[model samples]
Target: MAIQKNVLRVADLPQKKPTQFDIQPEAAQLDQITDQLELSALRKVRFKGVVAPIGQRDWELTAHLGATVVQPCVVTLAPVTTRIEEDISRLYLRELPEISEGSEIEMNTDDTVEALPATLNLDDILIEALALALPLYPKADDAALTQAAFTKPGEKAMTDDDARPFAGLASLRDKLNKDSDGSA
Candidate 1:
Protein backbone atom coordinates (compact mmCIF):
# COMPACT_ATOMS: atom_id res chain seq x y z
CA MET A 1 0.00 0.00 0.00
CA ALA A 2 1.34 3.38 -0.98
CA ILE A 3 0.84 5.62 2.05
CA GLN A 4 2.94 8.50 0.81
CA LYS A 5 0.68 11.50 0.82
CA ASN A 6 3.52 13.79 1.90
CA VAL A 7 6.85 13.25 0.17
CA LEU A 8 10.00 15.34 0.55
CA ARG A 9 12.63 15.03 -2.10
CA VAL A 10 16.17 14.37 -0.91
CA ALA A 11 17.50 17.08 -3.25
CA ASP A 12 15.35 19.68 -1.50
CA LEU A 13 16.99 19.22 1.92
CA PRO A 14 19.30 21.99 3.06
CA GLN A 15 22.94 21.02 3.43
CA LYS A 16 24.11 23.69 5.87
CA LYS A 17 20.97 24.25 7.98
CA PRO A 18 18.03 22.20 9.20
CA THR A 19 14.70 22.45 7.41
CA GLN A 20 11.50 22.23 9.41
CA PHE A 21 8.09 21.07 8.17
CA ASP A 22 4.58 20.89 9.58
CA ILE A 23 2.21 18.08 8.55
CA GLN A 24 -1.58 17.94 8.86
CA PRO A 25 -3.35 15.49 6.67
CA GLU A 26 -6.58 16.34 4.88
CA ALA A 27 -9.94 14.74 5.77
CA ALA A 28 -9.80 12.32 2.85
CA GLN A 29 -6.26 11.38 3.69
CA LEU A 30 -7.22 10.82 7.28
CA ASP A 31 -10.04 8.54 6.17
CA GLN A 32 -7.64 6.53 4.05
CA ILE A 33 -5.19 6.27 6.93
CA THR A 34 -7.85 5.14 9.40
CA ASP A 35 -8.98 2.49 6.97
CA GLN A 36 -5.40 1.33 6.52
CA LEU A 37 -4.79 1.14 10.26
CA GLU A 38 -8.15 -0.53 10.97
CA LEU A 39 -9.22 2.27 13.28
CA SER A 40 -12.79 3.32 13.81
CA ALA A 41 -11.97 6.96 13.14
CA LEU A 42 -9.17 9.51 13.17
CA ARG A 43 -10.20 12.93 14.40
CA LYS A 44 -6.92 14.76 14.03
CA VAL A 45 -3.22 14.28 13.26
CA ARG A 46 -0.45 16.87 13.48
CA PHE A 47 3.31 16.65 13.17
CA LYS A 48 6.11 19.22 13.39
CA GLY A 49 9.58 18.06 12.50
CA VAL A 50 13.04 19.07 11.39
CA VAL A 51 15.38 17.35 8.96
CA ALA A 52 19.05 18.10 9.56
CA PRO A 53 22.06 16.89 7.66
CA ILE A 54 24.52 14.94 9.73
CA GLY A 55 27.91 14.26 8.05
CA GLN A 56 28.38 14.40 4.28
CA ARG A 57 25.59 12.09 3.24
CA ASP A 58 23.74 11.20 6.46
CA TRP A 59 20.73 12.99 7.90
CA GLU A 60 18.41 12.93 10.91
CA LEU A 61 14.70 13.56 11.22
CA THR A 62 13.04 14.50 14.48
CA ALA A 63 9.39 15.26 15.06
CA HIS A 64 6.76 15.93 17.71
CA LEU A 65 3.62 14.06 16.69
CA GLY A 66 0.12 14.10 18.10
CA ALA A 67 -3.12 12.41 17.11
CA THR A 68 -6.68 11.68 18.22
CA VAL A 69 -8.13 8.32 17.28
CA VAL A 70 -11.07 6.07 18.09
CA GLN A 71 -10.95 2.29 18.20
CA PRO A 72 -13.36 -0.44 19.26
CA CYS A 73 -13.02 -1.69 22.81
CA VAL A 74 -11.63 -5.17 23.13
CA VAL A 75 -14.39 -6.46 25.39
CA THR A 76 -17.52 -4.38 24.82
CA LEU A 77 -16.82 -3.30 21.25
CA ALA A 78 -17.65 0.28 22.16
CA PRO A 79 -15.75 3.14 20.59
CA VAL A 80 -12.82 4.13 22.80
CA THR A 81 -11.27 7.47 21.94
CA THR A 82 -7.65 8.27 22.74
CA ARG A 83 -5.23 11.16 22.40
CA ILE A 84 -1.59 10.35 21.69
CA GLU A 85 1.43 12.64 21.82
CA GLU A 86 5.02 11.56 21.29
CA ASP A 87 8.48 12.60 20.08
CA ILE A 88 9.95 10.44 17.33
CA SER A 89 13.40 10.38 15.71
CA ARG A 90 14.97 8.54 12.82
CA LEU A 91 18.50 8.52 11.38
CA TYR A 92 19.03 8.31 7.64
CA LEU A 93 22.21 6.74 6.38
CA ARG A 94 23.61 6.96 2.87
CA GLU A 95 24.82 3.40 2.98
CA LEU A 96 24.25 0.49 5.38
CA PRO A 97 26.98 -2.02 6.24
CA GLU A 98 26.80 -5.37 4.43
CA ILE A 99 26.06 -8.50 6.46
CA SER A 100 27.36 -12.04 5.89
CA GLU A 101 24.96 -14.85 5.05
CA GLY A 102 25.12 -16.73 8.37
CA SER A 103 26.14 -13.96 10.77
CA GLU A 104 23.59 -12.41 13.08
CA ILE A 105 22.69 -8.83 12.21
CA GLU A 106 23.21 -6.69 15.27
CA MET A 107 21.22 -3.45 15.20
CA ASN A 108 21.40 -0.34 17.38
CA THR A 109 19.16 -0.67 20.40
CA ASP A 110 18.46 3.02 21.07
CA ASP A 111 18.19 4.82 17.74
CA THR A 112 16.60 3.63 14.47
CA VAL A 113 18.87 4.03 11.43
CA GLU A 114 17.66 3.44 7.89
CA ALA A 115 18.93 4.01 4.40
CA LEU A 116 18.05 7.39 2.88
CA PRO A 117 15.62 6.99 0.07
CA ALA A 118 15.17 9.33 -2.89
CA THR A 119 12.11 10.78 -1.16
CA LEU A 120 11.13 10.84 2.50
CA ASN A 121 7.50 10.01 3.22
CA LEU A 122 6.37 11.80 6.37
CA ASP A 123 2.90 10.23 6.20
CA ASP A 124 4.41 6.75 6.47
CA ILE A 125 6.31 7.79 9.58
CA LEU A 126 3.19 9.35 11.05
CA ILE A 127 1.23 6.13 10.49
CA GLU A 128 3.97 4.07 12.12
CA ALA A 129 4.19 6.38 15.14
CA LEU A 130 0.44 6.37 15.63
CA ALA A 131 0.34 2.59 15.38
CA LEU A 132 3.02 2.26 18.06
CA ALA A 133 1.22 4.70 20.34
CA LEU A 134 -2.15 2.94 20.10
CA PRO A 135 -3.31 0.75 22.98
CA LEU A 136 -3.06 -2.98 22.32
CA TYR A 137 -6.28 -3.66 24.23
CA PRO A 138 -8.60 -0.70 24.59
CA LYS A 139 -11.58 -0.61 26.97
CA ALA A 140 -14.47 1.77 27.46
CA ASP A 141 -15.03 3.64 30.72
CA ASP A 142 -18.12 1.67 31.76
CA ALA A 143 -17.33 -1.62 30.06
CA ALA A 144 -17.04 -4.71 32.28
CA LEU A 145 -17.67 -8.44 32.24
CA THR A 146 -20.51 -9.64 34.49
CA GLN A 147 -20.52 -13.04 36.18
CA ALA A 148 -23.69 -15.16 36.44
CA ALA A 149 -24.55 -18.63 37.63
CA PHE A 150 -24.61 -21.14 34.78
CA THR A 151 -26.69 -24.37 34.85
CA LYS A 152 -27.57 -27.02 32.34
CA PRO A 153 -31.16 -27.83 31.40
CA GLY A 154 -32.99 -29.76 34.20
CA GLU A 155 -29.84 -29.62 36.39
CA LYS A 156 -29.03 -27.60 39.51
CA ALA A 157 -26.63 -24.67 39.31
CA MET A 158 -23.03 -25.48 40.38
CA THR A 159 -21.47 -23.48 43.19
CA ASP A 160 -17.79 -22.43 43.50
CA ASP A 161 -16.99 -25.56 45.56
CA ASP A 162 -18.29 -27.76 42.76
CA ALA A 163 -15.41 -26.51 40.59
CA ARG A 164 -12.76 -27.67 43.12
CA PRO A 165 -11.37 -31.21 43.10
CA PHE A 166 -10.72 -31.32 46.91
CA ALA A 167 -14.09 -29.93 48.08
CA GLY A 168 -15.12 -33.34 49.61
CA LEU A 169 -12.13 -33.29 52.00
CA ALA A 170 -13.65 -30.46 54.07
CA SER A 171 -16.94 -32.37 54.58
CA LEU A 172 -15.07 -35.55 55.61
CA ARG A 173 -13.00 -33.61 58.15
CA ASP A 174 -16.12 -31.97 59.61
CA LYS A 175 -17.92 -35.35 59.96
CA LEU A 176 -14.88 -36.93 61.68
CA ASN A 177 -14.69 -34.01 64.17
CA LYS A 178 -18.39 -34.38 65.04
CA ASP A 179 -18.11 -38.18 65.66
CA SER A 180 -15.01 -37.72 67.88
CA ASP A 181 -16.81 -35.03 69.92
CA GLY A 182 -19.86 -37.28 70.46
CA SER A 183 -17.68 -40.28 71.61
CA ALA A 184 -15.71 -38.09 74.04
Candidate 2:
Protein backbone atom coordinates (compact mmCIF):
# COMPACT_ATOMS: atom_id res chain seq x y z
CA MET A 1 0.00 0.00 0.00
CA ALA A 2 1.13 3.59 -0.58
CA ILE A 3 2.38 5.23 2.64
CA GLN A 4 1.22 8.63 3.80
CA LYS A 5 3.03 11.39 5.74
CA ASN A 6 0.80 11.61 8.82
CA VAL A 7 -1.79 9.70 10.77
CA LEU A 8 -3.10 6.43 9.30
CA ARG A 9 -6.60 5.16 9.79
CA VAL A 10 -8.13 1.77 9.07
CA ALA A 11 -10.07 3.09 6.08
CA ASP A 12 -6.93 4.63 4.64
CA LEU A 13 -4.96 1.38 4.71
CA PRO A 14 -4.86 -1.17 1.89
CA GLN A 15 -5.79 -4.71 2.78
CA LYS A 16 -8.26 -7.40 1.77
CA LYS A 17 -10.24 -6.85 4.94
CA PRO A 18 -10.27 -4.47 7.91
CA THR A 19 -9.34 -7.44 10.10
CA GLN A 20 -5.55 -6.84 9.60
CA PHE A 21 -2.99 -4.39 8.24
CA ASP A 22 0.78 -4.38 7.66
CA ILE A 23 2.73 -1.23 8.68
CA GLN A 24 5.94 -0.18 6.95
CA PRO A 25 7.94 2.89 8.04
CA GLU A 26 9.13 4.95 5.10
CA ALA A 27 12.06 7.45 4.75
CA ALA A 28 9.71 10.36 5.40
CA GLN A 29 9.04 9.08 8.87
CA LEU A 30 12.64 9.80 9.92
CA ASP A 31 11.74 13.45 10.37
CA GLN A 32 9.91 12.67 13.57
CA ILE A 33 12.93 10.91 15.06
CA THR A 34 15.61 13.46 14.17
CA ASP A 35 13.49 16.28 15.52
CA GLN A 36 13.31 14.78 19.01
CA LEU A 37 16.18 12.28 19.46
CA GLU A 38 18.83 15.09 19.43
CA LEU A 39 21.64 12.51 19.49
CA SER A 40 20.76 11.00 16.11
CA ALA A 41 21.82 13.28 13.29
CA LEU A 42 19.95 10.91 10.94
CA ARG A 43 22.26 11.09 7.94
CA LYS A 44 19.86 8.58 6.42
CA VAL A 45 17.31 6.51 8.28
CA ARG A 46 14.24 4.54 7.22
CA PHE A 47 11.77 2.01 8.60
CA LYS A 48 10.19 -0.85 6.67
CA GLY A 49 7.83 -3.58 7.81
CA VAL A 50 4.13 -4.24 8.50
CA VAL A 51 1.36 -3.72 11.03
CA ALA A 52 -1.25 -6.45 11.17
CA PRO A 53 -4.77 -5.88 12.46
CA ILE A 54 -5.53 -8.73 14.79
CA GLY A 55 -7.97 -9.26 17.64
CA GLN A 56 -10.91 -11.46 18.58
CA ARG A 57 -13.36 -8.55 18.34
CA ASP A 58 -11.57 -7.08 15.30
CA TRP A 59 -10.32 -4.24 17.52
CA GLU A 60 -6.73 -5.34 18.19
CA LEU A 61 -3.80 -4.01 16.11
CA THR A 62 -0.09 -4.84 15.81
CA ALA A 63 2.56 -2.96 13.84
CA HIS A 64 6.04 -4.31 13.05
CA LEU A 65 8.67 -1.77 12.07
CA GLY A 66 12.37 -1.98 11.11
CA ALA A 67 14.96 0.66 10.26
CA THR A 68 18.60 1.45 9.36
CA VAL A 69 20.29 4.47 10.90
CA VAL A 70 23.52 6.41 10.26
CA GLN A 71 24.58 8.71 13.11
CA PRO A 72 27.63 10.79 14.00
CA CYS A 73 30.19 9.82 16.59
CA VAL A 74 29.80 11.66 19.88
CA VAL A 75 33.43 11.57 21.00
CA THR A 76 35.40 12.40 17.84
CA LEU A 77 32.43 14.23 16.36
CA ALA A 78 32.83 12.23 13.18
CA PRO A 79 30.34 10.25 11.15
CA VAL A 80 29.51 6.72 12.30
CA THR A 81 27.53 3.93 10.72
CA THR A 82 24.82 2.12 12.64
CA ARG A 83 22.60 -0.70 11.46
CA ILE A 84 19.29 -1.02 13.26
CA GLU A 85 16.78 -3.86 13.04
CA GLU A 86 13.65 -3.55 15.10
CA ASP A 87 10.09 -4.85 15.35
CA ILE A 88 7.55 -2.51 16.98
CA SER A 89 4.16 -3.78 18.06
CA ARG A 90 1.32 -1.64 19.39
CA LEU A 91 -2.09 -2.69 20.72
CA TYR A 92 -5.04 -0.41 20.12
CA LEU A 93 -8.54 0.06 21.48
CA ARG A 94 -11.14 2.59 20.41
CA GLU A 95 -12.44 5.12 22.86
CA LEU A 96 -15.47 5.95 20.78
CA PRO A 97 -17.56 3.89 18.40
CA GLU A 98 -17.03 6.33 15.51
CA ILE A 99 -13.18 6.11 15.46
CA SER A 100 -13.31 2.36 15.94
CA GLU A 101 -15.48 1.98 12.87
CA GLY A 102 -13.13 4.18 10.83
CA SER A 103 -15.64 7.04 10.94
CA GLU A 104 -13.40 9.86 12.31
CA ILE A 105 -10.71 10.60 14.91
CA GLU A 106 -10.64 13.52 17.32
CA MET A 107 -7.56 14.79 19.18
CA ASN A 108 -6.85 17.69 21.54
CA THR A 109 -6.72 20.65 19.14
CA ASP A 110 -3.87 22.41 20.96
CA ASP A 111 -1.59 19.50 21.91
CA THR A 112 -0.11 16.37 20.39
CA VAL A 113 -2.17 13.37 21.30
CA GLU A 114 -1.45 9.79 20.36
CA ALA A 115 -4.40 8.38 18.45
CA LEU A 116 -4.55 4.71 17.61
CA PRO A 117 -6.95 2.49 15.76
CA ALA A 118 -6.80 -0.87 14.10
CA THR A 119 -4.30 1.54 12.37
CA LEU A 120 -0.61 2.38 12.85
CA ASN A 121 0.77 5.92 13.16
CA LEU A 122 4.01 6.41 11.27
CA ASP A 123 5.39 8.78 13.91
CA ASP A 124 5.26 6.16 16.64
CA ILE A 125 7.10 3.73 14.44
CA LEU A 126 9.88 6.26 13.93
CA ILE A 127 10.29 6.62 17.67
CA GLU A 128 10.79 2.89 17.93
CA ALA A 129 13.49 3.06 15.27
CA LEU A 130 15.42 5.75 17.17
CA ALA A 131 15.22 3.78 20.39
CA LEU A 132 16.73 0.71 18.78
CA ALA A 133 19.36 2.59 16.78
CA LEU A 134 20.80 4.39 19.79
CA PRO A 135 24.26 3.32 21.08
CA LEU A 136 25.62 3.43 24.59
CA TYR A 137 28.70 5.20 23.27
CA PRO A 138 28.82 6.41 19.69
CA LYS A 139 32.32 5.83 18.32
CA ALA A 140 33.82 6.94 15.05
CA ASP A 141 36.52 4.93 13.24
CA ASP A 142 39.22 7.05 14.95
CA ALA A 143 37.83 6.13 18.39
CA ALA A 144 40.41 3.44 18.73
CA LEU A 145 43.24 5.92 18.24
CA THR A 146 41.75 8.24 20.84
CA GLN A 147 41.57 5.42 23.37
CA ALA A 148 45.07 4.08 22.68
CA ALA A 149 46.67 7.49 23.31
CA PHE A 150 45.21 7.65 26.80
CA THR A 151 45.99 4.04 27.85
CA LYS A 152 49.62 4.08 26.74
CA PRO A 153 52.55 4.16 29.23
CA GLY A 154 53.49 7.48 30.81
CA GLU A 155 57.03 8.04 29.38
CA LYS A 156 56.30 6.90 25.83
CA ALA A 157 52.99 8.66 25.38
CA MET A 158 52.24 12.29 24.46
CA THR A 159 48.77 13.01 25.77
CA ASP A 160 47.07 15.91 27.56
CA ASP A 161 49.25 15.40 30.63
CA ASP A 162 52.61 15.34 28.79
CA ALA A 163 51.94 18.30 26.51
CA ARG A 164 53.60 21.78 26.89
CA PRO A 165 50.89 22.88 29.32
CA PHE A 166 53.38 22.75 32.18
CA ALA A 167 56.16 24.82 30.53
CA GLY A 168 55.22 27.76 32.81
CA LEU A 169 55.45 25.50 35.87
CA ALA A 170 59.08 24.67 35.01
CA SER A 171 59.95 28.38 34.78
CA LEU A 172 58.37 29.10 38.15
CA ARG A 173 60.44 26.36 39.79
CA ASP A 174 63.70 27.87 38.46
CA LYS A 175 62.83 31.38 39.80
CA LEU A 176 62.03 30.02 43.26
CA ASN A 177 65.34 28.18 43.42
CA LYS A 178 67.31 31.40 42.55
CA ASP A 179 65.51 33.47 45.20
CA SER A 180 66.16 30.90 48.02
CA ASP A 181 69.90 30.85 47.22
CA GLY A 182 70.21 34.69 47.05
CA SER A 183 71.17 34.41 43.37
CA ALA A 184 68.29 36.61 42.13
Candidate 3:
Protein backbone atom coordinates (compact mmCIF):
# COMPACT_ATOMS: atom_id res chain seq x y z
CA MET A 1 0.00 0.00 0.00
CA ALA A 2 1.11 3.56 -0.76
CA ILE A 3 1.91 5.35 2.50
CA GLN A 4 0.99 8.97 1.66
CA LYS A 5 1.56 10.36 5.12
CA ASN A 6 4.64 10.04 7.32
CA VAL A 7 2.66 9.67 10.50
CA LEU A 8 -0.01 7.01 11.14
CA ARG A 9 -2.47 6.67 13.98
CA VAL A 10 -2.10 3.31 15.69
CA ALA A 11 -5.79 2.98 16.40
CA ASP A 12 -6.71 3.32 12.73
CA LEU A 13 -4.69 0.35 11.57
CA PRO A 14 -6.30 -2.85 10.34
CA GLN A 15 -6.89 -5.24 13.16
CA LYS A 16 -5.90 -8.43 11.36
CA LYS A 17 -3.71 -7.33 8.44
CA PRO A 18 -0.15 -5.98 8.29
CA THR A 19 0.48 -2.55 6.77
CA GLN A 20 3.46 -2.21 4.45
CA PHE A 21 5.21 1.16 4.20
CA ASP A 22 8.12 2.67 2.34
CA ILE A 23 9.87 5.98 3.05
CA GLN A 24 12.11 7.70 0.50
CA PRO A 25 12.61 11.29 1.44
CA GLU A 26 12.86 14.04 -1.18
CA ALA A 27 15.95 16.19 -1.84
CA ALA A 28 14.91 18.86 0.66
CA GLN A 29 14.20 16.24 3.31
CA LEU A 30 17.54 14.60 2.61
CA ASP A 31 19.26 17.96 3.11
CA GLN A 32 17.53 18.37 6.46
CA ILE A 33 18.61 14.89 7.48
CA THR A 34 22.21 15.60 6.45
CA ASP A 35 22.25 18.79 8.49
CA GLN A 36 20.69 17.05 11.48
CA LEU A 37 23.17 14.18 11.34
CA GLU A 38 26.22 16.38 10.62
CA LEU A 39 26.94 14.28 7.56
CA SER A 40 28.85 15.63 4.60
CA ALA A 41 26.21 14.16 2.30
CA LEU A 42 23.38 11.62 2.24
CA ARG A 43 22.12 9.80 -0.81
CA LYS A 44 19.67 7.02 -1.55
CA VAL A 45 18.08 6.75 1.88
CA ARG A 46 15.24 4.24 2.08
CA PHE A 47 13.19 2.64 4.83
CA LYS A 48 10.93 -0.29 3.92
CA GLY A 49 8.97 -2.02 6.63
CA VAL A 50 5.80 -3.65 7.82
CA VAL A 51 3.74 -2.99 10.91
CA ALA A 52 1.60 -5.81 12.22
CA PRO A 53 -0.58 -6.37 15.24
CA ILE A 54 0.75 -8.74 17.87
CA GLY A 55 -1.42 -10.31 20.57
CA GLN A 56 -4.26 -8.16 21.95
CA ARG A 57 -3.22 -4.51 22.29
CA ASP A 58 0.39 -4.92 21.08
CA TRP A 59 2.03 -4.00 17.79
CA GLU A 60 5.40 -4.77 16.18
CA LEU A 61 7.35 -2.90 13.55
CA THR A 62 9.96 -4.65 11.43
CA ALA A 63 11.94 -2.74 8.91
CA HIS A 64 15.13 -2.56 6.87
CA LEU A 65 17.04 0.71 6.54
CA GLY A 66 19.50 1.42 3.75
CA ALA A 67 21.45 4.56 2.98
CA THR A 68 24.68 5.95 1.52
CA VAL A 69 26.37 8.57 3.65
CA VAL A 70 29.56 10.60 3.56
CA GLN A 71 31.34 11.84 6.68
CA PRO A 72 34.57 13.64 7.50
CA CYS A 73 37.48 11.46 8.47
CA VAL A 74 38.26 11.51 12.18
CA VAL A 75 42.01 12.06 11.69
CA THR A 76 42.63 13.66 8.26
CA LEU A 77 39.36 15.53 7.68
CA ALA A 78 38.92 13.83 4.33
CA PRO A 79 35.51 12.68 3.15
CA VAL A 80 34.78 9.03 3.88
CA THR A 81 31.76 7.42 2.25
CA THR A 82 29.87 4.51 3.75
CA ARG A 83 26.88 2.40 2.77
CA ILE A 84 24.72 1.50 5.75
CA GLU A 85 22.16 -1.30 5.95
CA GLU A 86 20.42 -2.24 9.16
CA ASP A 87 17.52 -4.40 10.32
CA ILE A 88 15.35 -2.59 12.84
CA SER A 89 12.57 -3.91 15.06
CA ARG A 90 10.42 -2.32 17.77
CA LEU A 91 7.63 -3.59 19.98
CA TYR A 92 4.95 -1.15 21.11
CA LEU A 93 3.09 -2.20 24.22
CA ARG A 94 -0.11 -0.65 25.55
CA GLU A 95 1.15 -1.00 29.11
CA LEU A 96 4.77 0.05 29.73
CA PRO A 97 6.43 0.11 33.12
CA GLU A 98 6.78 3.58 34.58
CA ILE A 99 10.00 5.11 35.89
CA SER A 100 10.05 8.14 38.19
CA GLU A 101 12.31 11.08 37.39
CA GLY A 102 15.68 11.20 39.24
CA SER A 103 15.06 7.71 40.54
CA GLU A 104 17.71 5.01 40.18
CA ILE A 105 16.14 1.88 38.83
CA GLU A 106 17.41 -1.15 36.97
CA MET A 107 17.09 -0.72 33.25
CA ASN A 108 15.02 -3.18 31.26
CA THR A 109 17.28 -5.60 29.39
CA ASP A 110 15.00 -5.54 26.35
CA ASP A 111 15.88 -2.47 24.34
CA THR A 112 13.27 -2.92 21.62
CA VAL A 113 10.18 -2.37 23.73
CA GLU A 114 8.51 1.08 23.76
CA ALA A 115 5.31 2.57 25.12
CA LEU A 116 2.56 2.66 22.56
CA PRO A 117 2.08 6.13 21.14
CA ALA A 118 -1.17 7.44 19.70
CA THR A 119 0.70 8.07 16.46
CA LEU A 120 3.82 6.50 15.00
CA ASN A 121 6.28 8.83 13.28
CA LEU A 122 8.22 6.97 10.62
CA ASP A 123 10.60 9.86 10.02
CA ASP A 124 11.69 9.86 13.64
CA ILE A 125 12.25 6.13 13.57
CA LEU A 126 14.33 6.39 10.39
CA ILE A 127 16.51 9.15 11.80
CA GLU A 128 17.08 7.32 15.06
CA ALA A 129 18.11 4.14 13.25
CA LEU A 130 20.50 6.03 11.00
CA ALA A 131 22.10 7.78 13.95
CA LEU A 132 22.62 4.53 15.81
CA ALA A 133 24.11 2.82 12.74
CA LEU A 134 26.61 5.59 11.96
CA PRO A 135 30.25 4.89 12.64
CA LEU A 136 31.63 6.52 15.79
CA TYR A 137 34.91 7.35 14.05
CA PRO A 138 35.45 7.45 10.30
CA LYS A 139 38.95 7.28 8.83
CA ALA A 140 40.46 7.42 5.37
CA ASP A 141 42.61 4.60 4.02
CA ASP A 142 45.91 6.55 4.41
CA ALA A 143 45.12 8.38 7.61
CA ALA A 144 47.85 7.87 10.22
CA LEU A 145 49.12 9.95 13.11
CA THR A 146 52.89 10.51 13.16
CA GLN A 147 54.86 10.34 16.39
CA ALA A 148 56.31 13.58 17.81
CA ALA A 149 59.09 14.25 20.34
CA PHE A 150 59.90 17.41 22.29
CA THR A 151 62.61 18.45 24.78
CA LYS A 152 64.05 21.71 26.13
CA PRO A 153 67.41 22.88 24.73
CA GLY A 154 70.47 21.24 26.45
CA GLU A 155 68.15 18.91 28.39
CA LYS A 156 67.84 15.13 27.85
CA ALA A 157 64.57 14.01 26.34
CA MET A 158 62.84 11.04 27.94
CA THR A 159 62.27 8.26 25.44
CA ASP A 160 60.20 5.13 25.85
CA ASP A 161 63.29 3.28 27.07
CA ASP A 162 64.13 6.02 29.60
CA ALA A 163 60.65 5.73 31.08
CA ARG A 164 61.41 2.27 32.47
CA PRO A 165 62.84 2.43 36.00
CA PHE A 166 64.22 -1.11 35.88
CA ALA A 167 66.06 -0.37 32.62
CA GLY A 168 67.74 2.67 34.20
CA LEU A 169 68.93 0.55 37.20
CA ALA A 170 70.35 -2.16 34.87
CA SER A 171 72.26 0.47 32.87
CA LEU A 172 73.60 2.02 36.08
CA ARG A 173 74.80 -1.41 37.35
CA ASP A 174 76.61 -2.11 34.03
CA LYS A 175 78.28 1.30 34.11
CA LEU A 176 79.46 0.72 37.73
CA ASN A 177 80.87 -2.72 36.85
CA LYS A 178 82.75 -1.25 33.88
CA ASP A 179 84.27 1.59 36.02
CA SER A 180 85.42 -0.86 38.72
CA ASP A 181 87.03 -3.15 36.14
CA GLY A 182 88.95 -0.24 34.59
CA SER A 183 90.15 0.99 38.03
CA ALA A 184 91.40 -2.50 38.99
Each candidate's TM vs. the true structure? 0.76, 0.45, 0.78
Query: Which candidate number would show the highest lDDT if scored against the true structure?
Result: 3
* Candidate 3 lDDT over residue span 22-126, tens digit each: 999998888888998999999999999999999879899999999999999999899999999999999999999888999999988998999999999998899
* Worst window of 10 by summed lDDT in candidate 2: 56-65
Q: What Cα-based lDDT does every candidate model obtain?
A: 0.89, 0.54, 0.92
lDDT of 1 by residue, 17-94 (tens): 998889998888899889989999998799889999998898899999999999999989999999999998999999
Q: Please tell me which model should have the higher lDDT, number 1 or number 3.
A: 3
Note each model's CA RMSD in angstroms. Answer: 4.4, 12.2, 5.2
lDDT of 1 at 10: 87
> Which residue segments of model 1 deviate by more than 4 Å?
1-3, 104-107, 147-184
- Alpha carbon deviation, residue 34, candidate 3 (Å): 0.3
lDDT of 1 at 39: 97
Deviation (Å) of 178 in candidate 2:
40
Q: Where in model 3 is the C-alpha error above 4 Å?
A: 1-5, 98-106, 149-184
Cα lDDT tens digits for candidate 2, 36-151: 56545554344444544445323333344444555677777686767665554444444424445665677635322234555555665567546755786778876664434645
lDDT (C-alpha) at residue 64 in model 2:
47
List pairs with backbone clashes in candidate 2: 20-53, 21-51, 21-53, 22-51, 23-50, 23-51
